[model samples]
Target: MRAYNETWIENKNVVSQAERWHRRSLLTDDQLTAVRKAYPVGFQTMNGFLEIGLFIFTIIATGGVFLLFVELLSIDDSSIFGLYCLLFGIGLAILNNVLIRRRQFYRNGVDNALVMATTALMVGGFNSQFLDDGSLWQWCLVALPLLAAVVWYYGDTLITFIALAVLYTCLFDLTLEASFGRTLLPFVGMVVSGLLMQATRMIRQRAYYDDAVSLTQWVALAMLLVSVNYYVVRETNWLLIRSTLRRSGVMSPPEIDLPWLFWLLTVGLPIGYLWQGFVRKNRMLIILGVLGVAAAVATIRYYVGILPLNVHLTLCGLFLIGIAVGGIRYLRSSRYGFTDVPDEDSPDEFLISSDVITAAQVAAGTSGHDQHDNVKFGGGKFGGGGAGGGYN
Candidate 1:
């Protein structure tokens, strides 16, 4: 009985020692390192490349715009044909698209392509040459609507805005050039295009507000301002007004000019951009503000140039006053434009609060603020205090 009890105690001691050794082996340096290395990581996404590629494309597009302008300026009275140039530009646009696709990932290729294509179409308009007897300007009246149609089909606001710009330019040419008939086509076309752009934006329900809308509105506003200045200058002198307005169509039974149509560009147009930037939180709204101020200054400068120093200063002061008041109003009402991302599981929708303005945000500026500081905006919020990922 004593020998049996001693044997059982010895067996128990052996089992305990083996278990201790096994645990110690698992805690060894080699085993610890292997376990650390086994954690799963997800880092194969190409988002970095996508961003870099987009920047490159933007630069290329800018260069292309410069080239188009240079070609337009080179045209002379003797040389009438610009169709060749337009065709050449279209070809280059196509080739550029192909190269961009090959060099970059296909994330937003369609969007990029549509923008380039729209640019090509507008450049084509600039190259138009009228071949009628003694008339060197070709009719570009047809291209505006066609281009807008394409933009609408693609559901691309950037390109649609370009189409709108082209239409607005056409309207300017019509009113200033005296081709009132020509203006009708683009006027109706742009109103329709603008509606289409608004509709697409609504239907698609974009997750974020686009800055391009602001830019386009600025372009339109500038055009309207220039037209206004031209009209005001013409009103003071009938002969000059007659020459400027005679380019398109005759009014009042082929003699009297219709002046009311001219104010539509100035009085009604800037309001669009004002709404976008001040109310919609569009960054492009800043552009509208700049252009609006410039237009006002240019108009005042035209009138001020003929006046004495005191009058000029007073005119300038008045202009500044109007601008300041508008700026204050716009700033006070503007919403912080930011994208709100919601969690997949949570019922609560997360949005960027207006209080957490960053340097980037200050730089972007919400409304009525100078573009000196950076104010960061647009990001999702969460319950956790720290950010997490699938892997460290």
Candidate 2:
């Protein structure tokens, strides 16, 4: 908080917030007390309750504005749409800049969501401007570098995930469309991307990479799981030759039985993820592994309906229960990764806790990091890691 003028002192509210920021760092104690003493009374009550509602309000406000345009303007021209997207992008970028100028970047709870929404606007503008042809959405791939550069430069942690998601989507579509980029390539790509995020974070941890690392982990995991799940359901044998011929109008896509590899991966990959997750204490992998197991079973049951649903479900429930009981019994005197993890403040596990201040934690809690860094707290090796640690 740079003091731009002497009024910064007369304006005790900002001083108090600045002190709060200092406390969050957990650096000094007496300095905080002295600052509070100088600026006591007429406490600047931040409308945090109102701030909570602001997210919903921001979303609705954006939609309302767009809706008004659609309803009142009767603008159906594509050029007009392009103009609107460009104008909206410019407007949102300016608005975010305004907030930054007001020093509300980290202060306002709604800033992140607002900025992410703006990202969509910017991407829309890019699409309207560049993707004028009505071709496969694959053209969106060109926007990847542009959006990635913008997000990297903009320095919004939340936007990183969106950018990465777009990147992955393009990769997936391009791979699926092409004959060569099939089978295990996309799956490997996703898993590698996730692992790289973990590895990079470990090597270059810092305060700036917090949200980007946390959010992208989930997105990468999702891509991995979806790719693996698709492999379980379908066969990719001779895809290149087949797709090549089909593209040249030589043959149509053939109907074929599920490959042996599909079943092998369906059962094997899930167990592998589960085992790795348990041993490595990687919750993301464990979760994907557990869900993978269920999906594998469901896929099997969907294709093979020899038994009644009730009977299959009963057997599954009993099997899961047996595993739970045996596992719990085996580890009763010991410990498991998830067994000792403390509960987070947010029920929405997707959200960052420190970024979110519950009424209780807000009133009673002292300043501290959101405990998002896994190395600083409880987490698996691949989980959200501690930042600010220098790379070796």
Candidate 3:
């Protein structure tokens, strides 16, 4: 009876150990999956919190600035205080971003969102001309370039550069010499936009390309320079065309006869078309480019003496349709190429095939460049492979 009891106890001990091992294996698998799911969610939540916090702070800061201006409306000395609020607000913004970054999150999403929000706020504030007390929003203007430099230094985004360019252009509107020949702003903006596009192509980073999303920014910059040219040229006789348009056939803006704004529209549309054409390098793009240049010339002729709006609009419509056709052709041409084994002496360093590397040990005896490279990493061939050849 004692021997039977001893045998039963031995059997129970073995079964308990097996059960414990089985539970541990199952728990380990569950924990792994839970960790994988939680990591991404945790990062996203952190990013969302920072974005919301920064946006709220900017609004509150702007409000405080507005109130300060209202309070100091009577004194010439109040400009100094308004400047103080602007500087302090900008400082707080920079500090907030630094703090938000210290908390862990998906780094790319956090950086992109914060930079985008900040730039959008700057542009909106510029558009609103936030400080209307005849101060030219001077403090905001001065801080903008500094903000741009910081963006360039550490932001690692294409939008950051584009925002910098726009800020540079905005200086024109803020300047005392806007009435003079200060078309430098828009010209520089266009150049910067093109350079950024090239940088995007070479770097293959999406963040940089996002900055070129400013269609209005491009147009506004162009108009500033064009307006300068119109004033210098002084072709006021074009106003007679408005009467002709009214009498003959088409409805147009009441101020359409003015050469200043109309000439800008004339130059802008063609420049946009030509610029896209040259950048893209398609045959159709080249043709559209010619048409755009021609249209601009035609518009100028109509305004000056000879042609008319209806004819101009017709040619413009045809040019636009051609632009769409060219775009589709360009898209179709950009297909991905096949992955191939790279030439040994070629400049390219190819990524290895995962499948070949996985089963590499079994076929280690087979002489291949890949096996030689694998062995270098201490992944030895299966046969007589020491620590250097066998799986570590």
Candidate 4:
């Protein structure tokens, strides 16, 4: 076997792109040479973007193929198009199976890309076959579960995150009539996610459920962040009234959108999550809390852009720099409230818990940057907790 530096592998786990790429600052000349020659990470390479672009192209290409197939069949009926969805979906699924079963690991990007395209086809086909009523809630009911099965079979975190997003958004849409559910969902999400996080800990204590742990943690943290961030973006009363009107088509009393209440939710709730993170020494909690804080700031910026853009950028930049320094200082100190008891089978999940993996990085000074924080309201797929392996 050819020797290569694994430092890049380790360094890529650092979330900040700066930290991952500027390895020359830390490594010696020999190590740098090794890093340069080493194979790029599967999901973390610059090629990921190229792969994404190609994946999108593939979806479009697949749709065109579906259309061409329909044309060849000469089916003039609009309803017959639904049949096309079924045909195309099955074809894609077959291809996905073949690629996964037969292809080399070097072509995982192609496999994963095909799987994503397959998901779109399957969803469209299922919806066309059954959801003739054009109800989003109904479509979600049919589609989310199927997509969930894809996630399980594929074992992809990205897919898992997507499913959670679909579930959350659809539930939000369905429950908008009650101001309480909308308000409570994300809060409920936080608690539920925290429970999930605790479950990861238990799994780690016993067996270190590599893929399962990573998937669970990323999902939980994403849930926590969504819960905390939603509380601030808008008043629940607005959603309540809108949903009620949509559902009933009646002369319902309008609920007022009180700005004052949102001000508290937008600013205070994140502080609360942050405080809870500090209290529990929960890394995901802290990371979500930080994201919640950023979301709050974004909410404020959206509602109140009183300052000039440059000044806004400058202030935000300064604050982030301070936060980075403060966080590093805190973690380096034994006062690191985010301490986990020394365990052999710890830190197995995706990088955030990636069920998101920052606690290990930000607190314990470890790096596993396979975190999937860039997603919200998605299509779930994963690859066993960003495991570093190639198809042999």
Give the clash count for model 4: 26
- For candidate 3, give the lDDT: 0.41
Name the top lDDT candidate: 2
The Cα local distance difference test for each model comes to 0.41, 0.55, 0.41, 0.54
Each candidate structure's TM-score, on Cα atoms with residue i matched to residue i, is 0.37, 0.63, 0.36, 0.57
On residues 178-290, what C-alpha lDDT tens digit does candidate 3 reach at each position?
55323333344345445543554565433222233232223333333333233222332234245766677755533323455546745664466557655664333333335
What TM-score would candidate 1 get against the native?
0.37
Clashes of each: 26, 1, 4, 26
Q: Which of the two candidates, 1 or 2, achieves a greater lDDT against the reference?
A: 2
Q: For model 1, how does the per-residue alpha-carbon lDDT over 1-392 read when each residue is reduced to its tens digit?
A: 11012222233233323323433473564543333234211111123245457646765775586567657766544333355455544655565555534543222343355356545644554445433332222234555655654544333445655566666555545554564543343344445446545654555332122233433443443433443433332443344345645665543122224434544444444455566666765554444444544454444344335776677667767987997787566656443643233221112211232222222223322111111111111111110101111010
> Worst 10-residue stretch by lDDT in candidate 2?
383-392
Stretches of candidate 3 off by over 4 Å are: 1-91, 102-141, 153-298, 301-315, 318-392
State the displacement of the C-alpha of residue 199, model 3, in Å, after optimal TM-score superposition. 11
In model 4, which range of ten residues has the least summed lDDT? 383-392
Question: Model 4 compared with the native: what TM-score?
Answer: 0.57
